[model samples]
Target: MSNLEIITESRFTTVFIIKMLYAFMCGAHLDSIINEIRELEKPSKNYKRMKPATKFIKQPLEGLWHKHYEQVGLKSMAMNIKQQMGLNNKQQKIFNNTFFKEFCDIFNNSEIPQDKRIEALGYLCSGKQYIDRINDGKLTGEWIIYHHCNGKNYYLNVGNHSDGDDALAQEIREIALFEFPFFKGSLPIFD
Candidate 1:
């Protein structure tokens, strides 16, 4: 039996005291017992004990969150997307619950830069056909872009798509080349 098992088995008040005293008298063995006690007192690292869903449930979704982000910038972006996509009340509600909530969660997790937040939201919403509605032979709005790659349809809000302005495309190319100096060839033309 282990030293901890022996220590715990002694229930009587006087007996427990005597056992501990005997362990301390043994010097080297006493250190192990003390170490075991310390280990038992530490907080658990077991993820099974954690409820990740509880965190999502408790996330601030209304009132203060809306008022705050609205005052900042996300609200304006959401409104722009809503107007451009012609979302009705019901559709707007669904959009808020899904994409907007996920966007807020990203910000809540860390102080992400505005550009990074936009890029993340664009990436998150990409590859979904529902947001890929076309208008006047072009993908409408700043929120969605439909691009064809390898016979598959992908949507992106950022990056060099055909609909993106020349300045924006050049900026993306420059950023890419600056970030990865080894890439000598041009980026894939997302037509």
Candidate 2:
């Protein structure tokens, strides 16, 4: 075996004889050589550090949804949607749950960057029917207005075909332009 190859020996035996000799020739202490070997054996900081798979956090909007839709009975986007789509409490819950899950799936994926998560979610929500079986193709005409603030996604409104697609699209643009004017991601086209 090469002098650099580690030999299987008793615990007390010298593991690095070649290293020791080299150290001795260089006027370095055995302890210093051992420390050098230990350092070499230690894993690098880069190797030890691993990025978390998901940094996507879902803020609960159930209370907000209830407050905005149930308490006031105002003619907001969600209300319009609820009325037009005739979504009961159970159907609403299912929509919220499924949408949240799909959001999590996209955001938690480490492959997608923080800036792009919202865009990806927009694409999915616009195209995919998450709770199709229950909502009778609800997502087909869904409009979700969201604000990405400090890495947190705040879903502001949920509209549908009943609310008028142009109105919903314009609402999103106005919110992005006026409310979150400093937003990073370009406005995602839902057409």
Candidate 3:
């Protein structure tokens, strides 16, 4: 998990504790509040006794998880293809399958609405470094590009697909569309 995810989720933890503390200060049930405080102060047990129902539920599913560890569904299975990409005269190496899944997970978990989530993904992926790399070159965009490789980040106009070598450019365009759909609006670098 990223540090930002941890921080955002932790806001709830802070709010819960503060609410409990506020009730204590307001003198709402002195004995119950003191007992609650004591309960929290006590260290949690290192081991938990497994419930019988949990065992019964999981018994039949034991080996099922192992067979599907790398893939959860059809969409994920489709992304499992291995591919390499390069730009700026160097190889860029990030597993597109893994990266796409990560973005999908983030978008799925986020509170943002589904259609708007794509815009959020675009903004997140199009950080200054990616934009700057493209601005320094012949390419143009406010859009962000994630090569199947990580280091080969670049910027290109939305719908402009003349990257990579002759054979690889089409494949690169396909991967770019899969990963960087945020370039709905990309301005040229020169006028």
Candidate 2 lDDT, tens digit per residue, 80-184? 344433458887787687778888999899988877988887655543432232243221222233443454443433443365545544544444444344543
Best of the two (2, 3) by TM-score: 2
Consecutive 10-residue window with the lowest summed lDDT within model 1: 61-70
RMSD of 1: 27.3
Regions of model 2 farther than 4 Å from truth: 1-86, 127-191
Q: Relative to the unseen true structure, what is the Cα RMSD of model 3?
A: 27.3
Off by over 4 Å in 3: 1-91, 95-98, 124-191
lDDT of each: 0.34, 0.38, 0.30
Order of candidate numbers by lDDT, starting with the best? 2, 1, 3
Which digits, one per residue and each the tens of the lDDT, describe model 1 over residues 123-189?
A: 6565232233222212221211122223322211121123334443343344433433433332243
- What 10-residue stretch in candidate 2 is worst by lDDT? 62-71
After superposition on all C-alphas, the RMSD of every candidate to the true structure, in Å, is 27.3, 28.4, 27.3
**Over the full model, what C-alpha lDDT does candidate 2 score relative to the true structure?**
0.38
Query: TM-scores for all candidates?
Result: 0.21, 0.24, 0.20
